[model samples]
Target: MPFKTLLFSKQDTIAVITLNRPPMNALNSKVYKELGKVIDELNEDSSVKVVIVTGAGEKAFAAGADITEMVNLSTTEMHEFCLISQDAYNKFEQLNKPTIAAINGLALGGGCELAMTCDFRLASENARFGQPEINLGIIPGGGGTQRLPRLIGLARAKELLYLGDMIDAVTAEKYGLVNKVVKQSELMNEAMAMAKKLASKPAVAMKVLKNTVNNGVEMNITSATNFETNSFLVTFSSEDRLEGMKALLEKRKPNFSDK
Candidate 1:
């Protein structure tokens, strides 16, 4: 299906989704609706190997939600709106395939939440980030509260959310909010390169590893170890694993039927 607020392309097994509103690309209900639909489509399509998300303009990946529209909603309506946004973003985060958020510029409030929802994040030197909902007498209603604490420590998450102050990309990297900060011109190229490398790997093994890492923190040591043990057994029995081993023995690149 076609999209109104997003532009999607496929290259070298990576599905790139660009937020095309430009000039900050503030997300609204329509953007969330389209995003939810697109994400569902990607999840259903086995042909797509990886997903990359970025904004169209140089000014911001997404400055935040469309505050002008948000201000008009009643409290109940606002809660419902936030729930909708969370559903869409959680879909991106919990996708079986890995996702990368390439922050080209300011990623504040909902925008920051969106990037945090991805499996990994890379930002440009010109990028900035914040959870500035408190500045408006509100708070981050998306997955910010949970995801932020998980990424950085709870103390740092509190400082950023409570202060509602913007931090530079370098600071964000230092605080472990982002994986890396690159030159503005090289951000997408670098992100795509990483995406391509990931796409080349066996799909089920990648997803299983993602689940293991994500679930590890929420589980006890013994439980997490059991999960890892099961995952190890599962991977050993997979066709991809056999193919990978055989390719090593054959001294050739593996042709992953993704079996």
Candidate 2:
């Protein structure tokens, strides 16, 4: 299937989804619809061990939502739009494989919300981040209000939301908004390299590892620990676990079948 608002490609076990609305991949109805479709396909793709998301061109990952298309929307329509957008983003957030947002440029408004959905973010030196919807007399319609504080601290999330100011990649890293910052020229290369490394690991273990953290974080300590213990036992019963332990004793590399 062809996409009207995005570009999708696969490299071995890695799938790359680029927001493709030119210099600024502004989120609009088309983008949201296409993104939902893409994510559905990726979710069903067993061969894809990791997913990397970035924006086309150099100037912006996604400047923001498309205001021109949104300016005249009725309150009811806006509500529906927000739900559609959030649904698509949430699907990507819950994808079984690990996801990395390669933030190459400005990731403001909905872009910032999108990045927070990823397992982690790798930003280029030129990357700038913000939740500037307040500048337009609105607030974040996506998951920013919920996810931002969870990623950073409460105070920092408040500052970004209230002030609606853009922060440089270094500042974003300092605030724990991004994992690392790299040269703009090296962003894709570095993202692909990291994705490939993750791809080579035992897929079942990776899935279980992600599930342990994501599911455990929302529970009380005792409940979370119990969940983790049960998850560990689940993995302990896998063929890959046996192979991994046997390989360690045998002094050989383990070839996991993702079982």
Candidate 3:
């Protein structure tokens, strides 16, 4: 299917979704709608073991939401838009395969929120991040208020949200908002290399690992530990588990079936 607001392509077992509203790839209703559809397709695709999301150009991963469209929206319309955007992002986050955000430039407001939905982020030296909704006399409506604190500490998250100031990629990495930062010229290469490495791992174990960590972090310690235990036990039933152990003993690479 064709997407008006994005570009989708697959490279071997890795897929890439590029936000395509060039000059700034601002998130809007159309972008959200297209994104939802694309995520659905990718989730159903068994061949795609990992996904990499980034902006079309170097200037921005997404500068922010489309202010031109939001400037005159009624309160009810705004609510609907937020809900739709949240739904789209939820799809992205819930994907069974790992997702990485390759942030090349500005990631502000909804852009920051979008990157947060990924399993992790890899940033370029030129990348900039912020939750600057307060600058527009508004606040983050797309899980920012929740996920930001969960990533960084409460105090740091508050500083960014309250001040609406942009942070350089180095500061973002220091705050643990991004996994790593590389030179601008190496961003895509680094991201794709990581994605390929992940794709080559035992798929079923990777999926279970992702699920365990994502769900466990939101639960109490006791419950999270029990959940992890159950997940670990379940992996023993998978064919990959047997292959993984057998390959270890045989000193050969495991060919996981994701079973």
Candidate 4:
């Protein structure tokens, strides 16, 4: 299906999703709806082992939510709106395939929240990140408050949230908000390179790794270790594992079927 607010393309095992709202790519209800649909499509496509998300232009990954569309909502309407946004983003975070956020420019407010949902974030030198909802007399209704602290640290997350300030890509990298900062011109190339590398890994094991880490973080050490043990057993049963081990002894690269 075609999308009104997104551009989607697939090259080999990688799928790229571009937020298409012009200039700043301010996410609105339409964008969120289309994003949910796109995520659904990618989730069901077995051939797509990795997904890369970016914006239409170099100016912004997404500046934020569409303020014009959000400013007049009643309290109840706002609650429903937040729930809708959360649902869409949650689907992205829980996707079966790994996702990479290629942040080319400004990623603010809900934009920052969206980036956090991805498995990895590769930011360009021109990229700026922040949770600036406080300046608008509101808090981050997205997962910012929850995920930010977990990604960086409580002190740093609070500082950014309380100050409503934007950090440069280098600063973001130092704070652990981004995996790496590349030149703006090379952002997409770097993202595609990383995506291809991830695609080449054992698919079943990769999925299990993502599941374990995401779920384990919220569990106690004892329970998390037990969960990891179960996950290990599950991966051990895969044909890829047998092939991997056999290939090691045979002195050749393993051809994983993702079984």
Over 109-212, each residue of candidate 1 has an lDDT whose tens digit, in order, gives 98999999898899999999999989899888888888998899999999998999999999999999999999999999999989989999999888888878
In model 3, the runs with Cα more than 4 Å from the true position are none
Candidate 2 residue 12 Cα shift, in angstroms, is 0.6
**Worst-scoring 10-residue span by lDDT in model 1:** 208-217
Q: Note the clash tally of each candidate.
A: 0, 0, 0, 0
Candidate maximizing TM-score: 4
lDDT scores in order: 0.91, 0.93, 0.95, 0.95
lDDT of 3 by residue, 54-149 (tens): 998989999989999999999999999999999998998888899999999999999999999999799999999999999889999999999999
TM-score of each: 0.96, 0.98, 0.98, 0.99
* Winner of 1 and 4 under TM-score: 4
Candidate 3: 10-residue stretch with minimal lDDT: 201-210
The candidate 4 region of ten consecutive residues with least summed lDDT is 34-43
The model with the greater TM-score, 3 or 4, is 4
Clashes of 2: 0
The better candidate by lDDT, 2 or 3, is 3
